[model samples]
Target: MTPITEVEGRRLALSNLDKVLYPATGTTKGEVLHYYAATAAGALLAHLRNRPVSFLRYPDGPDGQRFFTKNPPPGTPSWVRTTAVPHHEDKQARQVVVQDLASLMWAANLVVEFHTPQWQADAPGIADRMVFDLDPGAPATVVECCAVALWLRERLAADGLLAYGKTSGSKGLHLLVPLEPTPADRVSAYAKGLAVEAEQELAELVVRRMTRALRPGKVFVDFSQNAAAKTTATPYTLRARPEPTVSAPVTWAEIDECRAPGKLVFLAGDMGARLKRYGDLLGPLIDPDRAGRLPSAR
Candidate 1:
C-alpha cells in the first residue's frame, strides 16, 4: 500500500470528506480536512482515557484508538470514511464508560458527554441499559432514522425492554440498555439475545426490501451485537458513513425538529424542534424498577 503522511492524508481526505461534512462556516480549514480524523483521535484520547476501540477500518494495534480510510480487515473498508485506527489515545480506561452521541464530531471536536456505565464491579451495563439498533439498508433521511428510533422505543417498551436511542452516524439508531457492569462478554451475550429475539418479533413489521434478509424494512432489532467482544460504535465515534455525521444524543422531546443528525441535544442550535417536548421519555427505561431488569438478560 502507498504510505500517506499526515498532511497528504488530510489533503487526500478532504477531497472526499468535504462533499459529505460541508463543515461549518469557520470550524475547519480546507488544508486540515483530511487529517481531521486524526485530530479527533487526539480528542477521543483526552475523553475516553482507558477504553478499547473496535470497529476500525484501517490497520492499528489492539486497544488502538486509531482511524484510517482503507479497507478494514475482513468486511474491511468500514463502508464509510474511516478505514482504520492506531489506538484510542488513552489506554488506561480511566473511567466506567459507555460512548454515544456527538462523541465523534470532529467539528464539535468530539466533545461528547455520556452517562457512566452503571453496574457492579463484575456486572455489564446492558442488563439495565436497554438499547435498540435501527439500521436502514436503503437510503434514508435523518428524519426517518429518528422516527425509527421512537418506533423501536415504543415497541421495546411494549416487550418489556427499556429503550433509549442514539444516532449511529451512518444511518441507524442505537437503543442502549444498562447492564449491571459485568464482563464485556456477558454484555455481548445479553445484546445478542435481545437482538435475536427482537428480529424474531419484528418479523411481522419488516418490509420486503431484500430477499432472505435479516428481516426487512429500514429497521432490524439489532441486539445480536451485544456480545462481550462485540462493540457498537459507541456514540460520537465517527462512522464511515458518507459525509460522516456523528451519532448524537437527543432528548426524547428533541427527536423531531432536529434536521441534522450531528447536532447536539444539550446545546444544539435548535433544541425546541427536538422531541424534548416529551421530556426524557427514554430515561426511565434505564431504571431497574421501570425496566424490571434481570440478572441473566441473555
Candidate 2:
C-alpha cells in the first residue's frame, strides 16, 4: 500500500518513495519530498505562492526522458488552485498555482522541477520582477558569470533596481531585479536594454544574442526570460541534474568571492545549514519595500 500522510489537513497518498530520482547520487523520491516538506513552509512557498507553475517532470530520473507540462497533470486534486491563462489568439490554458505546503508536496511527489514566470497568477499581464539568466557556454563557467554579475549589479543599481543572485542549479547564474509591478512589455524592454549595454561594455565576456556560435567562451545575458510567456526555474527548487543540485540563492559577497564553479554549486543536502546561516538571500525580492521602478525606456 502507498504511504499516506496529512499536510496541513490535506491527506496525500505518496507513491514510490524509495524510487531513485538522481541516479548519480542515488537520491530518492522520498528525499526530494522531504526536502520540499522541510523548506516549502518558509522562503520556498513565498516565491511560489499564487504563481502559475510549469513542471519539468522526470519520473525515471535524470537519465530517462522527461517532459514539460503547463497544465496540472491528470488526477489533480479538487482543492489544488488553478487559473486560466490567456494563450495566443483567444485560447486559454488552465495551469496549477501552488499556494501552500500540501500543493507543493503533491507536485513534488510527481518528481517535478518547479518553474514560474515573472508575474503571479492574479496579475499575469504585469511583471513584478526582471530576470537575467547568465548562461556560460562551455569553457566558461559560473566563475565567469561572477564578473558579469558584478557588472550587471552596478548597472541595475544605476537605474535604482536592487539585484539578487542565485545559481541556475545547472551551469549558470540568475540575477533578478524586483519591480514595482510594471507592464511585462515595459520590463522586457528595460531588461533588453541592459543586456545590450552589458554586451557593449563587456564585449569579450558578454553576448546578448541567442546565437549558439556566439556563446562559446562567453556568458549569455538571457534577458528574454523576462518575457511574459517564458518561465524560469524557481529559487530553492531541485534541478533534474545527475545530482540533487538546487537553484539556491546567494549573497553578493558569495558572488564576489566565488573563484571556482564548485564554490557556487549547492546541493540539496546543503540547504538546511545554508538557510540557518544566511536565511533567504533572495528575501529582498519578496519585500515590497525593496521593489523599484524600471527607468523610462531609452
Candidate 3:
C-alpha cells in the first residue's frame, strides 16, 4: 500500500517517491514534491491561483515519452479545484486550478511542467498579461535574448506597460507585461506590433517571423502567447530539462548585467536563497496598482 501524507489537512497518497524524474541529475519524485512544497507558499501559488492549468507529464522522466493534457487526470481528488475551459468550437475541457498548497503539491507530483493561459478562469476571454517568448536559435543563446529583452523593456515602458523578465527555464527568456484586463485579441495585436518594431530597430539581433532559416543568430520574439488558447510556463514552476531548472522570476538589473548565458540559468536549488534575498522579483506583475493599460491600437 502507498503511504499517505497529509498536507494542509488534506490527505494525499503519493507514489514512487524514489523514482528518478531527472536521469542526468538523479532528481527523484520526492525531491520534486519537496521543491514545490517549499516554494508554493511563497509566491508560486499566487501566480497560479485562478488560472486553469495544462500539465506536461513526464511519467518516465524527460528521456522517456511525455504528453500534454488540459483535462484533469482520472482519479484526481475531489477536493482539487477545476474549471471548464472551452477549446476547438463546442468542446470544453475540465482543467485543474491550483488554489492552495495541497492542490499544488498534488499536481506537482504528476506534472513536470505547469502551463497557464494569460486569462484567468473567471474572465475567460480577457487577458490580464501579455508575454513575449524570446527564443534564441542556435548560435544565439540566452545571452542574445537578454539584449533583446532590454530593448523590449524600454519599448513597453514607452507604451505605459511595465514588463517583468523570467528565464524560460530552457534556452530562452520570457518578458511579461501585466495589463488592466484587456481583450486577448487586442493584447496579441499590440504585442505583435512591438515584435515587428523590435525586429526593424534591431534587425541584426531580433527576428519576429518564426522561419527557422532566419533564426540562426537572432532571437525570435514570440508574440502569439497572448492568444486565449495558448499557454505559457507558469513562473517558479520546474522545467523538465536535464536538471531541475525553474522558470524563475528575475530582476531588471540582473538582466542588464548578464554577460554570459550561464549567469542567468537558475536551478531548483537556487530558488530558496533567491526568494530570501529578492522576495519575489515578479511581485509587481501581480500587484493591482501596477497593472498598465494597453495603448489604443495603431
TM-score of 1: 0.47
Candidate with top lDDT is 2
Cα lDDT of candidate 3 equals 0.90
1-298, model 1: which lDDT tens digit per residue? Answer: 3232333123122122222232332222232233323333333333233233333431111122445321122321122132111235533322222132222322222222222222222332323343456665544444555665565567556655555666665566666754343455565555555445544655544332233354334455455454432345544444433233445545556665556644422212222233334433344533446544435552
Instruction: List CA RMSD, all candidates.
Output: 10.8, 1.0, 1.1
User: Tens digit of lDDT per residue, candidate 2, span 1-298?
Assistant: 8999999999999999999888888899999999999854588999998889999999998888899999879999999999998798547678999999999999999989999999988899699999999999989999999999999999999988899999999999999999899989888888889899999999999999999999999999999998999999999999989999999999999999999999999999999999999898989988899999987755
Which candidate do you rate higher for TM-score, 1 or 2? 2
Q: Which stretches of candidate 3 lie over 4 Å from their true place?
A: none
Assess every candidate by TM-score: 0.47, 0.98, 0.97
Candidate 2 — worst ten consecutive residues by lDDT sum?
Answer: 85-94
Q: Write the per-residue lDDT of candidate 3 for residues 1-298, one digit (tens) a residue.
A: 6769999999988889999988888889888888899864668988998999999988888788889988899889999999988777647667899999999878887855999999999999799999999999989999899999999999999988899999999999999988899999999999999999999999999999999999999999999999999999999998878888999999989899988999999988899999998998888878889999998766
Candidate 3 shows a clash count of 0
Candidate rank order under lDDT: 2, 3, 1
